[model samples]
Target: MFKVYATTPESMGPCGIAAHAARAEAMGFDGLHVPDAIHDGLLLAALALQATRRLRVGTSVLVAFPRSPMTVAVAAWDLQQLSGGRFELGLGTQIKQNIEQRYSARWDSPVPQLREYVQSLRAIFDSFQHGTPLRFEGEHYRFTRLQPFFNPGPIAHPDIPLLCGAVGPAMTRMVGRIADGMITHPTNTPPEYLRTVCLPRLRDGLERAGRDPAALRLILGPLVATGVDEQAVAQQWEQQRRLLGFLYSTPAYWPSLELFGWQARGAELQALTREGRWQDLPAVVTDEMLSAFVPRGSYAEIAEVLRARYAGLADSITFPMPQDTAQDTQAAAAIARLRA
Candidate 1:
């Protein structure tokens, strides 16, 4: 999971990110996923690579609409080469509002647009490795020029895996066809959602691409709120409820709410957010809604709960950090149990 708490513009320079990465790696996280909200995801990926020795690093998503495919390929290639093949390139088509308003970028046909984006990156990487002239022209992206001076030219690790952050079926299928892995939106995914909605779509995508089912990884991160005791669990749930409310405020992320027949609640939250009523948003998410998404238990039981819920389903689950030094020891024990 991302250390997004420390990822502010002031603090997330090389030193700050390196410290967080070192701490996370020391805690035995297998990978660091950089998020794309306040900070640049690609830049965070680079910093993570520079900071850690053994841990893998990737973007939860680098927004696809703002950056060209060639630019992405260049950065990912350098990170892969520098990190000795431990870089994963994860992309996403962010919501239309963010694309149009936040970035001043155009947004249309995200599914097909992202498909061509991934294709273009692959084509560019291929040209760099094989010395072939880059010639990929799709409806959304065109890359027909690559001078020798521009190409980074054949690193030790050319096959950097491309992962996509997706919630919808069309995007999931596109990921299965072209991407190496898929990151599920935590708000839209629970264990039941994975078994029913996510896995089937992934299978269909793999079948459509004529690829092996085992080739793609199903990455999931349930909202895990683990604590040492009852009081801590209560506090964690409160925190998670606020986060859930914020996510449900986005209409694009209403699938899980829809599943619970709380789409109306989501609409109400959206209206509150539009009126700049951020303080009132958390009230819209009921305790029942919070329980439906987040898994709350003691630190000792959380790993087993996750394994039982997602065994044979998720290739990797996001590692939740313990609150204190005492819980950290317990958390490590839990991680060992999951590995076993």
Candidate 2:
């Protein structure tokens, strides 16, 4: 069956989180992905888990650089156990600047760091499950012995799935080679690019690792806004476009957007940023750009578009809900239509 996953913004208020999770669970959503940004992802996940019983709660991504692997392992394991195995730990290595400036942590060689991080997490989980001594020494991390005091106890299913949020070829392949799934970023990737470029790289990596590509889950991340008012929806899209435009102009994000033929607009977006004319973004964003990136329309139209766009490649399509609106009703209605 095609799965439907909804994305929760990083800054979602407590009421918003509870309301969305409750509605999504009632609406029969497959999962709820909470993004990791300037907020505490684990805290939010705990809240969501408490709020909904059936829905699988996940972190859209928890940056590896911010905290130690041991810390992440314990928290994820605890959450999984607490949620009755209804948790997926989505991991990612954010850009260097965020890692350094925001998290106040070191950033170096993400691929290797990611590998070691996963390995360490697995080791910790294994130690708890099999009652074996856990000791791992990698270039990035080392653990001679993990105390039982730190263990979160056994889970109904100790094997918590790890999903990596990656975009570049190396990271995409790495996700295929190691992670249980890959979560594609929304800034620039189109559905076809995921099917052609990202999926192929992932498949090749899986082949090299003697793993089946079909076993890996593919998650398509897109900014979603749905409303009764078309003009309001368009304005929301414009705001999203400006934010995405700024992201597109960045060195890290530019490469991805450039691949999707969005590089030319980078200069104009940069100019907008320089002049503090963000409100003028709507005028500059062409219809083609909106079609290629942001998904906008009435609830039914947007849901159908998402279903069609994701089609066969993704196991789930994750749509982020805006904060200002009453998303429960719209989300429930959309899910009912999509499932039907």
Scored by lDDT, the top model is 1
Residue pairs clashing in model 2 are none
lDDT of 1 by residue, 1-340 (tens): 2211111222355545676666667766777777777777777778888888987887877898999888889889999999999898878998998899999997989999999998999899999999999999888889898889998898998999888988887888888887899888878567777777778888889998899988987677567777887788889889888888888898888887777688999899999989999999888889888777888878678777777777777778776666465666777666666666
The whole-model lDDT of each prediction reads 0.79, 0.77
User: What residue runs in model 1 are displaced by over 4 Å at the alpha carbon?
Assistant: 1-14, 323-327
Q: Taking the tens digit of each residue's C-alpha lDDT, what string does model 2 give over 1-340?
A: 3677877866676656778787668767888988678567887788898898899999989877788988888888888888899999999999887889987898989988998888888888888788778888899999887677866667787989998988677887888888899888876357766667877898988998999777798877777656656876777777777667656555566555576676767777668768997666556667777677777777657778777766677767775554545665776677766656
Which candidate comes out best when scored by TM-score?
A: 1
Query: How far is 317's C-alpha from truth in model 1 (Å)?
Result: 0.8
lDDT of 2: 0.77
* Candidate 1 minimal-lDDT segment of 10 residues: 1-10
